[model samples]
Target: MTDLPSRVSINEEGPREGFQIEPGPIPTADKVALVDALSATGLRHIQVASFVSPKLVPGWADAEAVVAGFAPREGVAYTALWFNGAGLDRALAFRDRLSVTGSISLSASEAFSRRNLNRDREGNLAAMRKQTAAHLAAGVPVRRLGIMAAFGCNFSGEVTPAQVFTAIEDGLSIAAEAGVALTRLSLADTMGWANPVAVERLVGAVRARWPALELTLHLHDTRGMAVANALAALRMGVASFDATVGGLGGCPFAAHKGAPGNIASEELAMLCEEMGIETGIDLDALIEAGHRAERIVGHPLPSALLRGGSLRAMRARMAA
Candidate 1:
């Protein structure tokens, strides 16, 4: 067995990323219930919603309402995603009232940057810089800077490692210039194009380059490699990951519409538990939450843990 971290951290993004791509709008009350459920499951971080244009994502238009609905737990940290100054403004307005952290996401691939945010690479970087500074100024802790499409892009096909490096450098430079310390840095495989080999290679390079920064992987299971890629990352010392409940989330702007969403949080946690790596998550409660997510989304989710019972339960059943 490869040496692993004593305790792994998982950030549940189901309330935001997972629900963002759903065709039907999830009611604010239901979204709040799902988030509240996740928060109670010993998850330290939960991304509640994104502050984006209602025109672009009608589902999250009730971002404020969702924030208002969920009861805040003392130990759990709530987060909101913002891509630009406008989104930052929305988050800032609620900063005092809500217990929320902030995330600033920028795409590495110029093609995706343009398609997703109507900006080129440089433009997106500039926006990220501005948003990061603004978020800090507003007293919202910008915990993470998400580099989207770091592994590869749907539009551009293969993204070079150097490009990903440059983007991270630029983002770090901006953060330094603004005199803000980032708590985490995330590399997102937005298109699910990363393989296990690629994951090790990229994660190794980044760890070598920036040893101090906390690293997280945001993976998509479009090609059924999300878990494999995650395992590869874990071997390379990436202890933090972003996963959605019931495997619900996908980028609507990506080239492939049928691509799967983020890896299921329950499934990942179960894998960690079975491997003897601690995640501090209640497996049964998490599976129950996954079932709740399925009810809210009104569809069958893609969670192996939800479909196949936990390891112990399955073993007990077989023995019986």
Candidate 2:
């Protein structure tokens, strides 16, 4: 608890994560609205869309449109997800509006990679090597390493810290070979298999290995422990996280049938603010954004805070 960071950085993933998993098509305008609402909430980072093939992810076929649609808010860094050179090219078109940096992303679970990307661990590495080179060729600085399924995997079961370390090492090797120095690493609990103890152990282990690297957690709340796990990481001084508004995302390919999505952005924001950690986020505004997300998706989201609401307004009323 004493090691809690003075400020926490939350990367909003609602627009991309929520829409992409839904069965129905969401209007581009609604997606843009969520982005616009979230931006005004003092959130500094948002993952706006994924630039994959329409055949693969039809939800993001309108990625370019969404990118073109949003009114850019100053001081907020916008990001998008892409897997190959084509996706990279599409993202490059919006270089002026988006923070188009590259990441050397790997998966700790071999089974997850095979199913998720149709590539085995060795094959995935080879692809990453090519992707890293491509990114550098495009002048996109490849400075971040992301390890997906770092906590555990449904297909593989129980991803140990050693597997995660190996994934990080592979990513680092790719970066080094490309002459790209990585300053940040994001550990993803892609399927919501992380626990509080596991978060602490892995964070401590990673810090021991790469003490200088900034860490970010991408946690899923499928098993209902996302906030506790976040608190554990906070105690270990991890200040950056990837969250979705109203808990509006689930892994479509991770066999997460009816499971909850990523940790709710508003919940994480409320947690940090309640703990006296500055998140630079307007919790009420964020909650509004969550509500907007629910309206767009046309369903109740997984966020309890959204249903219960924050206590800030209640406190204000009591004071009055």
* Candidate 1 clashing pairs, residues 3+ apart or interchain: none
**Residue 17 lDDT in model 2?**
90
lDDT of 1: 0.82
Candidate 1 residue-wise lDDT, 174-242, digit = tens: 777877777788999988889989988888888788888889999888777888888888888789999
lDDT minimum window of 10 residues, candidate 1: 250-259
- Whole-model Cα lDDT of every candidate shown, in order: 0.82, 0.93
Off by over 4 Å in 1: 96-99, 102-104, 251-258, 315-320
Q: Candidate 2: what lDDT?
A: 0.93
lDDT of 2 by residue, 150-227 (tens): 998889899999999999999999888889899999999998899999999999999999999999999999889999
The numbered model that scores best in TM-score is 2
Q: After superposition, how far is residue 251 of candidate 2 from its true place, in Å?
A: 3.5
The TM-score between candidate 1 and the true structure equals 0.92
lDDT of 1 at 259: 59
TM-scores for every candidate against the unseen true structure:
0.92, 0.98
Segments of candidate 2 deviating more than 4 angstroms: 253-256
